[model samples]
Target: MEKIAIIGSGNVAWHLCKGLQNEHIEISGVYSKTFANSQAFAREFGLEVYQDLEMLNKAEVDLVLVAVNDDQTARLIEQIAAHHKVAYTSGSVNLKDIDHPQVGVFYPLQSFTKGKKVNLFEVPFFIEAKNMELGEQLFDLAWKLSRKVEYADSNTRSELHLAAVFANNFTNHMYSLSKELLENSKGKFEHLLPLIFNAVDKLKNSAPEDIQTGPARRNDEQIIAQHLDKLEGDKKEIYKIISSSIQKKYHEKL
Candidate 1:
């Protein structure tokens, strides 16, 4: 029964608390520089929020999970590591640079939004530790919350984070753009839900490059030009770049 204390109240911290508590981990307490945030979160979790970091220092915690911003992670971890085993939830930061032997990474590889319902059991947790002992402790904790726990070094975790930005952030922005385009044309974007869902379902069975379609994949110059002509500004630029890339890829196949 290793007790855990979470620092920060951002999306990652919120979701991590949810998942960890469900797995019966004692989120013994919470800490935040913003007093209101810590108070609110503590109320929700029915745990007291320590107003002073000194108070947190006095508590017994087997692990301190820091979910602060990337720039602040190292500083927070360093401070907490003096008396506690600390892990920062950051994908891009290298653990090697942190000189503490009790410091590690406990990054949850998923996009999170505050107040959104997230199924963390399906989300991957990437764990890294300063040594084998802390590594096992972190890995075992992650495994309790998720079926997709795995070990990833700093370099690999950073690359995976980059890939996630492309796959999730950029792709979601494209969807938002599509919705705006449909609204401008007097159409509801919900009509595209079936198409979007089907495409996602198809990818579960086939690689995207193998299942490529559309005028760009067919190298239909006329249709591509028409589509480009219909778009303008950043939209047109994005369309041209993606269309050209698709055409170049499949053309090499021929």
Candidate 2:
């Protein structure tokens, strides 16, 4: 098994390490700038922790997975350029900015949290590389980690990142808003949990347009107007915009 070193101790790094471990790949060590984070992660994974780049470079590893944040990715790549085949776990960063010839992207398109177990096989991995050979290597790595692996160029990957912001992050914000509204009404937010789960479940079998429902889908103008009246503050404006968008989409489908 090829040895892997991860250069961050955040959610993405943690999850990636767990996935790689499940595949029985050897994790040589983990490098984090913060000693506490590095120590904690190292203890959990039973791997050495390096707080310095020099220490990490000394470790026996074939690949270095950089899971640092967007702003720090380029700097980290430069710091580790000469040591090993460096790959980042970012969907937004351009691979050209990194100096390493073997640099690539091994972006897993899923929200990760520390202590949460994520099944990598269910998550889509978007692989990219500077050359065809490196691209194939990245794809093979992705395939080992996920059942759904796709080869995407930089532009396509960036576009997917934008779409993810809208589909996942923005939608999550909307869920929080829903919870807030329900709480304000002295209603249990848990009531909507099943509906939320079912909405996502429906997406697996049907297109979003085909599964859409509520007043907009039925063209019930009266209920729409009533909903608009019931909504208050910024929420009312947001409701109007979303309803308008839904209405426009519904009309386009006609």
Candidate 3:
């Protein structure tokens, strides 16, 4: 059984620990800067908590997984000695830029939220390692948790992360705006659920451009004006910008 130690107590660390616990891996310990968070995580997972990471440094573990913020990743990586095989779970951060021999990326390309259960097998793992052997090992480990595991270099990973922000973060923000728009109005956000689902289902079998149907895409200036009149401030600006972009995009094909 492979032993591993985690270096964080956030959402990623919790999910990583929980997922690995079901496998043949043994979680040796967990360390965090905050004692309350670290203690709480250790208690939940039945693992030892490390206040000073030197104890975990000396411990015999096959790998040390760092699931900290991008800002904290370099600090933690520098603290971990060369003797340990270290892997970080950051999507945008480049592993090549970091000065380390036994370091790699174990990025999972999916949004993680506290209390929300994520299907690990459905989530894709984008992996990159410092060397061939380490890459292979990281890939193997990722494959254990996710059926969809692929090799991605730092640059590719960063680009993918940027795309993910557009696809997930920006899209979710649009949903939030929709929900806000619905508040104190004639309908609730629930009214859009079926429409949203249909749009998503259509995307499975059709390209977005092919199925693009909206006042913006069709250049329906009347409806567009009505929508713009309903919106205010940043929302109105966002609508105009997107509508203009959509009209321009469709016009280019003609």
**lDDT per residue, candidate 2, 204-230, as tens digits?**
889888988988778788999999988
Better model by lDDT, 1 or 2? Answer: 1
Q: Stretches of candidate 3 above 4 Å error?
A: none
Instruction: Determine which window of 10 residues in candidate 2 has minimal summed lDDT.
Output: 77-86
Task: Please provide TM-scores, in order, for all candidate models, with all chains considered together.
Answer: 0.94, 0.91, 0.96
- TM-score, cand. 2: 0.91
**In what order do the candidates fall by TM-score, top score first?**
3, 1, 2
Name the lDDT value of residue 142 in candidate 2. Answer: 82
Give the Cα-based TM-score of candidate 1 against the true structure.
0.94
Give model 3 RMSD, 1 decimal: 1.3
The number of the candidate with the highest TM-score is: 3
Candidate 3 residue-wise lDDT, 136-175, digit = tens: 9989998889999999889999999899999999999999
lDDT: which is higher, 1 or 3? 3
- lDDT of predicted model 3: 0.90
lDDT of each: 0.88, 0.87, 0.90
Model 3, residue 33: C-alpha shift (Å): 1.6
